[model samples]
Target chain A: MDFQLSDDQRALRAGVRELLAGRFGRDRMRAALDAATGVDRALWRELGEAGFFALRLPEAEGGVGLGLPEAALLFEEAGRSLLPGPLIATHLVAGSVKGAARGEAVVAVLDAGQPVAHLGEADALLVLAPANAPRAPGGTLRDAAPVRDAAGPVRSADPFTPLWRVTDPVEAGEPLPGAGRLREEGALLAAAEQLGSAARTTEMAVQHAGAREQFGAPIGSFQAVKHLCAGMLVRAELARSAVYAAAVTADPVEIAGAKLLADDAAVRNARDCLQVHGGMGFTWESDVHLHLKRAWLRSGQWLTAAAAEEMLAGDLC
Target chain B: MDLAYTEEEQEFRARLRAWLAAVLPGLPAKPRPDDWPGRRAYDTAWQRMLYDAGYAGLHWPVDAGGRGATPTQHLIFLEETERAGAPYVGANFVGLLHAGPTIAAEGTAEQRARWLPPVLRGDEIWCQGFSEPEAGSDLAALRTRAVRDGDHYVVSGSKIWTSHAEVADWCELLVRTDPAAPRHRGISWLAMEMDAPGVTVRPLRTLAGSTEFAEMFLDEVRVPVSHRVGAENDGWRVTMVTLSFERGTAFVGEVVACRRTLAALAADARRNGRWDDPVLRRRLGRLNAEFRALWRLTQWNVSEAQRAGSGGVPGTGGSVFKLRYSHARQELYEAAAEVLGADSADLDREWVLDRLSSLSYTIAAGTSQIQRNIVAERILGLPKGR
Candidate 1:
């Protein structure tokens, strides 16, 4: 089996990394976090022009039509650079979103019963909108909702997207109540995000281990931290196999299992990465916290571990 | 990139599967062979059968009596063989796996032309005589001496952990040919008849009550100069090649088998009362995760081998695999024991012979601790730990 990435996928990842390395570097990440709107617009359009948003769209629809595997690699680079915006959600709903506006659009998967960021800022909103769930509604604000009236958006320690007040609360979408095509795609996408997050955190951990020193030596020399980093690499790579395999198969059962694995990997790797970075990881200046916060926040969104478990149990059984 | 096999490889797999299906002879219903030695011989005979059937050396070069398959084909062949639960190659274990290969690499043309074909044909067996009472992890500290006499080298001193030496036809002995040189630089490797006069083989009894390992004393066991595979004081290099092949694949078969066991154990827990224990389930979950991770590493290494030759990367992924896999293996057996409880018959019956065999994967191939050290020093570029 081929473990090497396709030339195009590799090129896509390299291109995205270059874009982020230039535009969404640490300096830009800090500025966007402090911004009132909580987004870096110029870079987002640059991504749009680069065909990042058109990854899943069919060739007939003027897009690359690559699967989640390719998308996962690109997002991993995004997480590595810690790029901003609700790119995942908008892409997830792109098939049904405004055509020409899909690339320019921004949206967030409702996090813990609240939409993250200002919903009104998006050209279109792609809310989970799970029917009949208890949540504080943002009420409709023209094309979007206005939930947060007076508040500064919180920027996670990560250099990426700043979290805004959850103004537009879409009720928890019923987990579709059944297993079919939609659940599969949703779970696979979740896995793709997790793969991105885990891979990013792993790189973060590796870099920290290499540079960070303790007692006149790189702390990575210590077996404890080495084992942790090694274990993190193991988990990230394992989940990757499942993720890539499921993407190849497009089988819901396989996808569900892979998603569960990838989710656990990202969540676990982020925590372990924080542990590896130790005090530095806890510092506000360190980017480790950003990944931890996002992993923590995302770990609960869409399919929470429990939700994925339930889906997995149903599908696998 | 296409992960699926090409047309030729698929056909190769199909043909090999069909041939194996047709030719694989039956074993005992309960496999209650007379004794360990008998079982070992049975395995040897089966290996010869496979050798004759042209499945023994799927990865060997065509010039060396192998199928001359590509690395991918070799991987497919190995995976398919494991899938078929093929028996281990018994008699030629060390010969074909180690000595013969060493000869092929460092031996003179006569040595390769003479020693390889017999071993390839399963007419001879070989055992490694590297470790001694003092040379455990510090293998270079071996004090076994082989001084040059007229036309032969008089070998002296003892070698421990000399497996299969008792029944084997020959021993691949590494000894100090020059005492004045550095510990690693003064050694020489020689292949000597196991039954040669002045050679003594005594089986070492382990706590498991089987004589799987041996201690051999060579009191002037004169090995002909023709048997010298490499230069006079350079057995260390030759021995390095022998020990190097000791690993690299990382036993993907064991990983697959353990994963199958893990799943079955989980399902068993669900059916036969133990499933409710959250602790056990959590343990299973951890093991399941570890298995997946280690298996991926194995696949990556195999892929690396497919792209690059057997000269694996200088990175410590092998060390990582050895470290993780050894612990996982011990965990798997221990978990099986836990599930079996005091009776432990189910576990025992499944692994009575293999239990002792399995312990050696870590201890024999390379100690887990040793692997960890390698990872730290070579792979991670860390300072040497005392």
Candidate 2:
């Protein structure tokens, strides 16, 4: 009944956190916000080199053989750093695609019947077919039909996450083995990211509340602001527990539960954090909005709140 | 990171479950919230049953007349007992949870011999005399006074929100022994007789129409100086120890009970056809998820204690779990009320009873406001507010 992270897990978490802090810290994230792709490829390569993309891959496959929990911890760091990219897709794809483990090939997963994320930027796209189909790949993504050049980039809520709609959709090909498992894993990892972002935003809000003074003292001295910060902390920590537990259990119901809490924490914590920063938080110069924007994007990813709720309701029934 | 209990812990749970299964049927049904007499007898019998079976004081050390179970085993005991629909420790709560541990920790040898055994055996009932009318959240500001009078302390002051005071045979009293000293420095912890001369207990009715709490008025109630748990004027630390235990595994049962309530509510929603409403479904689903997270958070804390090899006080995490559980509990009962709609007014329905009593979940132990302050100032390092 121990909940403490093993020394190895702790070291792994600290190592990922330190690496991300040094490589894709707030400053680096801000710089990438307005970049052409809104992603730091150099940092991505560095992460791949550090075995971030290969952590969950079997050691026999020339990769680090860690479990989904370890992978969740690494993605939590990514979320904390607000590292931009199709991180879960890329990491999961590395399991099937060669070169991806080395960060040489960028892979994006297209939700069945939805616009493919990183449609043009990614080197390959993997589409998940419905369960019960034959165990096979949905064809190599690079070989799939592409959208016309006239299809411009769709405006995204998060400036760091640019969306693209594909006009030329590929027909269903071969099905991947246990696509449902992959989807759950993807949701779990995304939840881990949301946990990180939630925690980071909480810290950001608390730091601002302590430093930014109004009236006669720091606004944190006021009950209203203090309660808001406290609420944010609660949301973040609750999501954290859910995320880590799901990582350990890897149960579909637990994963759905984690996604629900993580989405709430990520989105609500960012908004409350913005409120804590006041008018300055409304401006683009403030990173608080960045968190809110990213949270909005992630909430709609792999498993949305609505979808997660549906899964949990099914369990209740 | 393991959440599974040990084989020995599993065996303990199986044994407890079988015992509960066998004994629970023969016992009288649990009494209503207002059925104090019936409940007193039922609860006393249940505690004695538990004590005889070596289930009482499951978390305490063996030398202190407990099973010396690990933190995980203690949690399992709580979860399994609550899951079995057994009665709560009720009036004996203070004795088993608070005074017994305090005696073992800070009391003199004679005090332990005199006080600890009866508490485990359900032969004595205890109440806390800490909060006064003037001191609710800021408990350190308590003005309860106790002046030295040779062999005894002549205590004179009032204490509010003392649970089970009416039924309690003894009181863990906190009084100010030094009026000139700082508020937190002059306090003293004493084991006072509740039935002593010049002592008064006035039962206070709550919104639930239950007298689970009472106000204690002490007009020169003489408590032997030998009853002091610690050195004179050092009661503040002793009080802290007692309060920490109050916030400890006491909630483990509540958490399990809450999970059962949530499950029953979901079942109600389905029965009443309220589960189909997308809005209500989402709300119910979200709540189910929150409850799961809260349960996991508790497990994580217990696991942490096990990993630390420090037998579970929960420290600051206790406040976090309590605050979240309170909100979750209230929200759940409110949703149940919504599900019941007009049927919620039926007092016979258990959910209605829960809805009525849910408000106290946040108010007792420590209010949500106090909890947030602790989380902010202690957990998050937020600046203390004025």
Candidate 3:
């Protein structure tokens, strides 16, 4: 009945955090944000070398052997660092896509009729057709042909995330076995990332509240600000429980619910964090808005709130 | 990261389930809610059965004449008992949960022998006399004075919200022993006999219209100094210790019951065609997620307690659980009202009655506002509000 992170898992999380901090810390992240740079291929390959993409791959396959829970933890750190790329898609395709396990290739998934994120940098694009969509005759994974591009790269709310409109009458690639489950896994990972952002924003809020003074006292001493910070912690912790539990259970309904809560936590926490910081949070120079924008972007990714609600309601009704 | 129970814990669960199945049906029908004496008889008989079956005090220390079950085993006990429709700790709540544990932790050998056994056996039920009319949230401000006089403390002051006082044999009383001392330091904990002379219990009717709790008046009640659990002027710390006992798996049984109620609410919705409403269905679905997540949070807390080796005191996470669980409970009953429509106003309906009782969840134990302060000041390291 031990439902906490094991000693080994704790080490794994710490290791991932250290790696992300050393490689793509806040300074580097801000640099990319300022420059509006696309995905850093060097960091991508470094992450591959670190076995980030192949975390869940079998040890027999020359990959780091782990499970979804470990993957969730690692992705949580990635989310905390706001490490941007088609990480989930590339990780999902690690076993099937050549060179993906080593970060030599980048894979992106197109689903729910949304624009493909990081498509220009992606070596391979997997179109995960909606379950209700008519089955196409070809594979689900395909080469990223320019012909598939309906529109050029568009500005994204999250500056780190690049997006491209994929053409309609979208051609599906080779059949990906367990594609439905893969979507659920994607949702879980996305939820884990949101959990990380939620927690990070909470820390940022608390740190700011304790340091920022107003009316001759630390703003945190005020019940209004304190309660906001408290509420953020509650949301983040609750979402964390859901995300971690869903990772272990791998149940679709649970995953859907995890996504729903994680989205709420991330988006709402970021907004509250902004409120806590007062005027400073509104400036682009501050990281608070970045988190809010990113959370907004991520809320629409993988499993969305409306979709998750319907899925859970379907199970209940 | 394992959530599965060990083979031994699983075996414990199975054995307890079988025992509950065998014994529960043979018990007498439940007494009326207002029947204090009948309830005392029914609840104590159930506690005695648990004692005889070796299930009483599942989490108390072995040296204190308990089973000395691990935190996991204790959780399993709660989960299985609640699932099997077993009776709650009812009249024996204060004795088994609050006063008895306090005594075990701080009482003398003579005190243990005199008090602990009766509590474990349900022979002497206990009630809490801590909150006063003037010192509800700020309990340390209680003016429940008890002047020392030889071997006895001449106590005189009132305690409010004393649950089960009508049937309680003993009241776990807190008194201000040193008026000049600090607010937190001037207090002392005592086990005053509820039947003591000049002690009065006036049952207080809750919004739910139940007299399960009362206002207790202690008019020169001479409680022996030997009844004190800890040293004089240290009752505040003793009260804090008692509160820590409530953190980890305290609301676990309630979570199970809430889940059951949610299922019944869903069933009711389906029968009444309220399930067709997307808003209501989604609300229930969201609540399901809330409860499921709360259950996971419980497991996390228990695992943390096990790791910290704190003997099942779950630290500040209890405030987190309490803060959310209280609101979630209120939200669940609100959803039930939506499903019930106009019938929700009918007090005879179980959900209607529960909906009323759920109102106190955020107010009782610790108010949600108090919980927020605990979470902020204690857990988040926010500066204390002036």
| Strongest candidate by TM-score | 3
Candidate 2 CAPRI category: medium
lDDT tens per residue, model 1, B1-386: 33567798899899889877876656533233325556556666766776777776665666666666665676666667677777655556788677876887788878888887777776777888989899998899999988889889999999998777777888998889899998888988899988888999898876566777789998988899889889988898886765444233537666777777777666655766665665666566556645755655566666655665665344465666776677677787776655555545543455444454567667766686666567545654554434
Encode model 2's per-residue lDDT on B180-254: one tens digit a residue. 999889999999998899999899998887787889999999999999999999999886776554323557787
Angstrom error of the Cα, residue A217, model 3: value is: 0.7
Model 2 chain A, TM-score vs. native: 0.92
Better of 1 and 3 by lDDT: 3
DockQ of each: 0.26, 0.68, 0.72
Misplaced by over 4 Å in model 3 are A131-139, B310-314
lDDT values, one for every candidate = 0.67, 0.81, 0.88
Sorted into a CAPRI-style docking class, model 3 comes out as medium
RMSD of candidate 3 to the truth, in angstroms, is 1.7
Q: What is the lDDT of candidate 1?
A: 0.67
Q: Which residue pairs come into collision in candidate 3?
A: A138-A173, A139-A173, A139-A174, A139-A175, A140-A173, A140-A174
